[model samples]
Target: MRKTATTLADGRELIYFDDTEPYTSGAATRELRDRRDLDPVAATSTMRYDVLTGEWVTLASHRNSRTFLPAVAECPLCPTRADRPATEIPAEDYDVVVFENRFPSLARGAEPPATDHVDGDDLWPQRPASGRCEVVCFTSDHDLGFAELPLPRVRTVLAALVDRTRALSALPGIAQVYCFENRGEEIGVTLGHPHGQIYAYPALPPRTEALLRQSRAHHARTGRVLLRDVLDAERRSGRRIVATTEHWTAYVPAAARWPVEVHVAPNRDVADLTELRDPELEDLAALYLDVLGRLDRFFDGVGKLPYIAGWHQAPVEEGRELGRLYLQVFSLMRAPHRMKFLAGSESGMGAWISDTTPEAIAARFRAIAPGPVPS
Candidate 1:
């Protein structure tokens, strides 16, 4: 792959990952100059400490005015063409591209707040939300979804993500790096373009904290990796197993809370995507596409199933040894026409209630599995 990095008109970073002939061979160059007149980025987001839950909540009020469901002609994610207005990507076409978010919840180079307390209360401390948020455009074809991508294109996307993860993890004060995609309108995806997001957080998220606690405790008692053990147990039980490959396994968690949930783990223990070998990455691309195809077929008449898929990686500076990398995919679609809303028990409290059992979900997934894809 050929990687070319350039700056946007607004001073944000944009990168292109080219896998095709001329670009990869250095016979041609990507359009690096962003000529459109644009204003400089203004970052004013802040993080307030929630005393009750011991979590940091980012307040990016400016995001309220962000672009929402614009027409296809105005989609900023599309490639820049002469007939159309210049978009976020300066190139006329691209295999894969990633750029800083125009309206980010977190931003780079933010100055520290003058006072740490909120309303003179010692419990409510606040600070600048100094972090990085990026958007990964999977394809220039605005109509194509990720699952419909060719295998080579999928591989390029994975490579770009691994490259970003390594680069983001090396950045100062970045606690964790997360790569995720929210698909479909029901999943609250504002953009119809095929894309995902990368977040470099200044602080560890609550979910990572909870996972670390469990892993640490499990290691202390048994001296074995928690997730590795879970994978082994799941393989032995074979009850929630959805799909398995030479390097990966897809299964439903025994206590799944989503209407449809599947966790994909490496057969070998790895802390993050950066640790995955070439063979493993290739296997992942194939398995991911296959699983996603099955998900679309899971609910008849539902068309494309709206789901959230995220990579759970180890923190940059903490719990690396105890961490096991995995991809968690879940959808809010409880039925063909019904949606699962996080009610009082789930949203108000940290408790989850499931409408279907994990075994049933897994069985359905197994039944609908598309077998394999051509290389």
Candidate 2:
């Protein structure tokens, strides 16, 4: 599966890649293909990369128009429909359910083009597009967000994440697992359900790839994990520490790119939370909940605040201990009621101009005493 150009209805080019098709039998692909339980389902999502912007897009074929604004009475992700057919799941019985996204950004089981590369000055090799996109529903409740769920329930969600990570990482072509949640309509969510998507890619993303290069360089010289040392320094400095436990710490990064960006990283050099022992899993979950609770209290429970949360870890090819696993949450609010906008520098030049300093964001988060568990 390699990327080839396809034209969208709007006449823009959409680069398509189908992972199920053979591309290169590299080490990464071999590992990914072996994970049968989690590989791309028979009817998987379609993926295309944008040639100009270098952004990957997923288009899932299983999703129909009706799946977008489903009524509460017809919510299929709810627990009551565990045994229901694929098309008629009832809503309301599940604690956590992992399913194929109804309207996936990536369509499954697509066929890669026989030849995607063309002789042109602007052309680069299109990487094979193979991977799985899954939505993990956190709860069966129609209106409950992660912050509104009980502590134990939230723990279940985290555990599911770890499980899915492990399952997907074992597949043949997957090079990385990207997990994230986009909350609120401000982030352009088409559904009101409390769920997040997991993407198992055949190669590392550009940002992750860059981080890997930096870490490899650092390790070649210092024989230490860059993130591990950074976590230690941040703990000793204490300027940005939000909360710390035996296994995890939440703090604001000194080089934060957003106004209210909070990160929870493992004190040890664990690539992803999936590698944590059972006991450590609970600690990671506890720390995650602690930070989220703080965020909820900061916003006064309106739940209208928009935010994005994503996990950053070393690529699967880098081994499980190459980098410390961390979660970053960035709030869209830059001022009391105003949202931050990405103008010329950010949108056009790929440069970020932050309005708030990391130190100030850290101080503000520190001032808010950790409130009761969010639920």
Candidate 3:
């Protein structure tokens, strides 16, 4: 397969992939917007790909369809009571299970794929839809989140992620593996369960592609791995660093795009958690749980503080080796009851304006008590 891409006049990224065996060319396009142009309350849902930048955009208007507060009995992810059947339970006893989504936005059945239209009323060129999404049930217990999970359980969950990445990447048409978890409804999680999502895509994701390209360029110029060098610098500076062990370190990013963004990277370079030794995985998991616990302490045990956590691994392909794996976790909520909404400047202009200082946030996190971990 031959891949080609270029930037558009409007600063959007476009990529195309050509296959010799299949005799087909696949292309994708996307753009960064200032604000979503949709009725968040009225539109049930809509998915679009911005041709200029080459990224998939999913607008879930139904997010605001229901009332803000729902009874615990009505929670879809909750376990069934004595009178209810076992079907009402999200899953049986399992540490982590990957299953097909019941209500996925990128369903295999979503019709009239964006690539079908060469030219429509207002739609510019779009790319074919070729991606699969699976939900990773983190734990059987509804109350156990990443922060609450025992260290050994967290390692099991990370192992599950590694297994899923290896399994999904080996599929016939997968090029990228995206694993992410959204905690709390403030981050738009409908279900209040301890679960995450895995998206095995047929093509390289735009943001991943951009970071990979940047890492390659940086490596070419410096003859050193980008993330490894950055992690070393953070350790040497000892300012933004929040928590660190022999193998891993967690710190506030110097160029954070969000107010409460924290990045956890290996003290040594590794492609993914799968590549780490068992001991290293345990250390990493310990740090992960510690940081999350501090986050909980930061907001005085506000469990509903919305946050997103994900593993950014190198592409599954062999050629994309310059990239290093890292975990990026950020909260949309600036505080317990406050949110940082992406309005006009952030949504339409592709610019981020943060109100708090990274230094201050790092200091605040550092002051929080690091709870003991079993590992």
Candidate 4:
């Protein structure tokens, strides 16, 4: 693989990862400069600590002003043209590109103004939103979905993520690195391009904290890895298992809260994406493609599904022993024409109630053969 990093017009970092031999072998000539004259935007975000919930809430009001879904010609993720205004990517074409988010929820090394609220007070203390948020464009095409990419392309995407994970973890204050994709409008995707995001947080998020607590307690109690045990239990039951290969297993979690949820875990206990072997990555690409193909046709009338796919890896500074690498892919679509809303029980009370059972969902996923959706 070939990797090149450059600074965008606004002083943010943009990188390109090429998988072709010509690029990797340094036999292809390329334009490595960004050709736009843009002024830097003064943006900083603050984080308030929720004393009641023990969580951090980022206040990035500027996100409301970011671009929404635009026409294909005005898509910000597409390559730039000489006759058109320069988009986020300055290059005319790219295989996979990653850059810092223009409207970021968290800014690296940014210092927000201090507040007069008492630090000892229950719910008044605040801090700077010091971290990073990066956007990873999976393909240059405006209409391509991740599942439609070829395996070699998928492998390259994985490689890009792996490199970012390692690089982001080494950043001075980053605590956790989250790589995820929000696809389709139902998933609250403002852009229609095939892309995912990476969030490098200064503090461990609540979800990862809870996971570490569980993992540590489980290890202390059973002396076995938590994720490995879960995988074994699923394999033994065979009720929620969707698909399994020599290196990985994809299954609907036994206590799934979403209408459609699948967890694809490696057969061996791996700390993060950077630890996966070459054979493991290849097998992962194949299995992930299969699972996504089934998801595209889950509903009878919906040709493509709206979903969120995220990787839960070990935190950068802590929980290295108990942290495990895995992916959780779930959709919000409840039926052919219905949607799953986080109503009172879910959003207001923090309790989730799914309409479909895990076994049934697993069976549905298994029954659907991998194929293209009807045009």
Candidate 5:
């Protein structure tokens, strides 16, 4: 793959990842320049450390004014078209594109400066939410989604993700780099576009923090990688396995909290997406695409199932050794016509209530799997 990096009108960076041969030969037809005159990028988001939960909360008031569910003709993620106004992507067509988010919750060099004179206030500790947020466009078309893309195109998307993961991890003050996709309207996806988000967080997120703690404890006790052990247990049990390849495994976790949840982990102990070898990448794409296809087929009457797919990676600064790369895909849809909403037990207490068992979900996934597994 060839990378062509350029700057958007708003001074944000945009990169185009193109495949060799036919795509690169016809690259001249693609838009290489931004036609729109936009203002400079600015971010004032601040993070306040919560001593109670031991997590940072970002206050990005500007995000309230962002575009929400725009019409297809006005979707900012779509490629710039002659029939409509210029969108966020200035390209006429692109196999895959990633650009700095305009309404970002975190940004580079946007950190609040340090104060030397103030007394150490433990109760009101705040810092600049200085980190980068990039939007990964899976394709030029506005109607298609990641799960609907061809395998080759899916590989192209993974290439872009690997590129961004490596690049974002190198940025200063970046602690954790998370790549995630929010699909369907029920998932609170503001934009109905075929795109995912890369958030370079200023600090370790709550979920990653929990994983690091558990993994470190497990490693200290058993002298083995926790995720690898879990994968082994799943394979041995042969009950929750969703799909498997030589280099990857997809399973509905035994303690799955969501109605539909599956975790896809690389067989190797890769710290991040960048460490995935070529063969692993190839098979990862195929197996992930298969898992996604099964997800869409899991429900009958529901159109496109609303789901959140998140990549859990190790922090950039610390505990990377304990970090195991995995993708957690889950949905709140409890049934074909019913949606599970987080109420008092989940929202107020943080305790998840699952309407279905993990084994049942795994059985549904197994039934929809494209091919039968080996004995």
Candidate 6:
């Protein structure tokens, strides 16, 4: 893949990952100039410490005015055309492009307040939400989704993600990086475009922290990697296993809280995407596409299911040895034409109640899978 980085009209960074013949061979080049007149990005978000949970809550008030669902003609994610107003991407067409988010929750240039405490209270500390957020356009075609992308295109997208993860991890004050996709209106996706997001956080997220604690405790007790042990147990049981490749495995977690949840983990220990070998990455592209396809077919007559797919990577400076890379894909759809809503038990308290068992979910997935996964 050939990566070309450029600056947007408003000074934000935009990158193109070209994998096609002309672009990749250097016979042609991507349009580097963004000619549209755009306002400067002013990131005024702040991070407030949640005393009760010990987590940082980013307050991006400006995001309230972000672009919502728009008509196809006015979709900002579409490639810019001469006949139409310019969109976010200035190129006439692109294979895969990534740009800094216009409405970012955390920004690299955010300014913190003079005082550290909120209203002189030591319990509530506040700081600038200094980090990065980028949008990855899976395909220029708005009608196409990630699952429908061709194998080469999927590999290109994966390359872009790996590149961003490595670069974002090196940024100042970035403790952890997260790459995720939120699909469907039910999942609160504002745009109809097939895209994902990368978040470079200033601190480790609560989920990462929890995973680290558990892994550390497990290592102390058993002298073995926690996730590796879990994977071994799942493979031994084979009850919750959905699919397995030479370098990866997909299974429904034993304690899955969602109605439909699957965890895809690499067979070998890898802390992050950057550590993946070429063969592993290739296997990942195929296995991930296969899993996503099954998810769409999970509930008959449901059409495209609303789900969230997130990458869990280790922190840049902490828990590197114990961290294990994995992908968690889950949906809110419990049945056809029905959705699962997080109510009192889930929303109020930090507890989850599963509507279905992991074994049952795995059985359904196996039934829909297209036989054994390719070796």
Q: List the residue pairs that clash in candidate 1.
A: none
Error of 2 at 227 (Å): 0.8
How many residue pairs clash per model? Answer: 0, 28, 15, 0, 0, 0
TM-score of every candidate relative to the true structure: 0.96, 0.78, 0.77, 0.95, 0.94, 0.96
Model 4 pairs whose backbones collide: none
Against the true structure, candidate 1 reaches a TM-score of 0.96
Report the error of model 3 at residue 360, Å. 1.4
- Model 1: weakest 10-residue lDDT segment is 23-32
Whose TM-score is higher: candidate 3's or candidate 4's?
A: 4
Which residue window of length 10 is worst by lDDT in model 6?
24-33
Alpha-carbon lDDT of model 1: 0.90
Clashes of 3: 15
**Candidate 5 lDDT over residue span 1-375, tens digit each:** 778888777789988887745564126434456778887766888888777777778889888988899888899988776888988877677788899999999988775736411246767678888999999989887888777788888898998898899999998888999999999888789998889999999889888888889989999999998888999899999899988889999999999999999999988788899999999999988887788777887887665788899999878978888888999999989998688999999988899889889999999999985632211
lDDT of 3 by residue, 98-151 (tens): 554444444343344444445563565444444556676665577677788776
lDDT of each: 0.90, 0.65, 0.66, 0.87, 0.85, 0.90
Q: What is candidate 2's lDDT per residue for 166-191, written digit by digit as tens?
A: 87788777778888888877666666
Query: Once all C-alphas are superposed, what RMSD does model 2 give against the true structure?
Result: 10.6
Better of 4 and 6 by lDDT: 6
Q: List the residue pairs that clash in candidate 5.
A: none
Residue 197, candidate 5: Cα error in Å is 0.8
Mind giving the per-residue lDDT tens digits that candidate 4 earns over 274-334? 8999999999999999999999888887888999999999888788788888999999989
